[model samples]
Target: MMQLEQFYCRNYRIGPSESDFRSMYRPSAMLEHMQLAADGDLNAMGISTSEMLEQGLGWMLLATDLSILHPARLDEEVSLFTWSKGSKGVLWLRDFILTNHEGDRIAEARTSWALIDLQKRKPLRPSAMPVEVKAYPEHSLGDIPEKIILPEGRQTRETDRFTARYSSTDSNGHMNNARYADLCCDNLTPVELAAGIRRLQISYYREVHMFEQVIIERTDAADGIIWFRGMAADERGTVFEAKLQLNGAA
Candidate 1:
């Protein structure tokens, strides 16, 4: 682990299994690495999951905005840096930067989280936490839109409903955040997938539990961005929404 002035950094060598058909790091794998970095940072701050649970609290992700400039290839070593960007009421913000071995940035992400009461599942104020908030250097992605808007006049199509499997569920008893990327991407057309995703933004609205069937809907905007929405098949409403900006095919 490498420590910057106020950021926690970790090196990850992209594994063969982590690559997609394009031989580049998959979105889900990148998200998993980001989660690890977040865990490491929280642990360094003496607020690990167990510690939070002991205080009757837990962290819940609200949204994440990731921009990929270049994808990491198999066996490539990437450095990931993360830091807390303070909090706004009940919402805590964190940001990450991923760089290649040459030190050129490949991806950047910003995430929002809420501290929740474990039993009640209600958000708690960040000030109530025992840890000291630190002043950290900022790495802004230049106003990442919190909401992804679908272009007017675009047609929406729905995919076959599928259930949340055991393999997709996390300890929280819901589909893992990273798994949502896979689910969303699975709904993309082969052409769109082949074009390669250059950016992704996901907002988690509700938790989808194991065995709950989900319906994925997508709309392709005129600007080449694909917007996706995952709704509960049982009519419980929208569970998650995502947007993918694709690079033109070679």
Candidate 2:
């Protein structure tokens, strides 16, 4: 069991006049929390890698629901607690709780992941989980969420790619879980993102991490809905797909 310790960190940076309480604790901040959790998970599994290799496997692709409980304020100290929630076959389940210094719960997260053969970039059997770790226990995060699907015949509208930055990976040495959100959003127009979102969903077909290049493919948009898919070059064929809902411009 990986214990709750100082997993990872970043000091708060907002002045009283500069930011509001709610905006300060947006989903983006939660990304820091997820990065810490991914670190703990990697440690627990004993598959920890060096910074160089870790970046290639893109750490925990958070295939579950995340709920925010309380708002985190500027200058508040945030910490994370995580543990294995159990797994079904090759799907590994993990849970995380984010809290502030006063012990106030700020947010909760759960994730599902499939181990992949880093070289082949293909899904590996859950039975492949190291013998050192036990199978994920039983629990419900409501109905198991469905994976996001790429729209049929969607072609590349834009192709933006990134090499995992050293900062992108978590303590476990792989690309941090939250970076996926950053990457997904990178595919959108700034105007669309600023308008706000009602819901956002993404699915991980493969783990992406350091040094790998990823290509973003966008679906045709109409109304206020848009879809996208990202692919990385690898022997195994890993893909990341996402669907986004937008708020109309004022």
Candidate 3:
């Protein structure tokens, strides 16, 4: 059983405004919440890129699935509870629950990470991080949720592309995982689509490293569902997959 550390955060006024429903809550903001929570865990583990590698382990960005329950407004003093669920060998899991001051649930999210050898990029065993940081109480453990399925890939109907930059990649030397969600949302036709996001899932097939070109592909899987795939066109095929659910609202 893994014991999770609780994080209490005060919501700020810098979040997305109420101009429209789609932009009601930016994926970037949610990503920020996840980043903060992960940072806290890493600090608790006393594991940095250099420190972890000394123990025959390095960090690898994996995947994230976020579900929104309510909109967190700017400057709204909300509490975000985060904790590490479990880790099997090299793979690590973290869960988060965002709530208001009154104990109302706002959003829930889960992300996957891996610790690997810095030189060869191979996974390391569980004894890498310190025992206290790695050991988490399991009595209140929540079930790991499933990632959304990408129905299919489709030929892109639009010609817009986001320019790749070096800053997008994190310490793992790959494009920051959260930015992929932004790329998928950037491709949306704002005029035609009018809905709030309920769920988002992304699977990383390959890594998009520094100075690489990435192409965004979209798929319409039927009514009320859509899929987006991103690929690094240098030599490798696809790199990542993104799926989103948007509700049509007036």
The 10-residue segment of model 1 with minimum total lDDT is 136-145
lDDT of model 1 at position 66? 88
| Of 2 and 3, the candidate ranking higher by lDDT | 3
What's the lDDT of the predicted structure labeled candidate 3?
A: 0.64
- Over 125-244, each residue of candidate 3 has an lDDT whose tens digit, in order, gives 766555445434363325443544455345544334555677787765677777787787777677424455767778776677777887777875346556787766674887777777
On TM-score, the leading prediction is 1
Instruction: Give the per-residue Cα lDDT of candidate 1 at 185.
Output: 75
* Model 3 ranges with Cα > 4 A deviation: 1-23, 48-50, 53-57, 134-149, 152-160, 191-193, 248-250
lDDT of each: 0.81, 0.59, 0.64
lDDT of 1 by residue, 62-133 (tens): 898988888779889999988877787788888889999988889989888888887887988977777875
On a 0 to 1 TM-score scale, where does candidate 3 land against the true structure?
0.79
> How well is each residue in 1-250 modelled by candidate 2, as lDDT tens digits?
4334533333334344322333554454465556555655566566654532454443345474566555566656666666565566666676666777766666666677766666655556755545355333443344445687865666657557677768776554556556666676666676665655544566766555678777777775567677777777564565677766665512
Could you arrange the candidates by TM-score from highest to lowest?
A: 1, 3, 2
- Misplaced by over 4 Å in model 2 are 1-29, 38-64, 67-73, 77-83, 97-108, 115-139, 153-156, 169-175, 197-199, 207-210, 220-225, 233-238, 246-250
Clashing pairs in 1: none
Error of 3 at 206 (Å): 2.1
lDDT of 3 at 57: 59
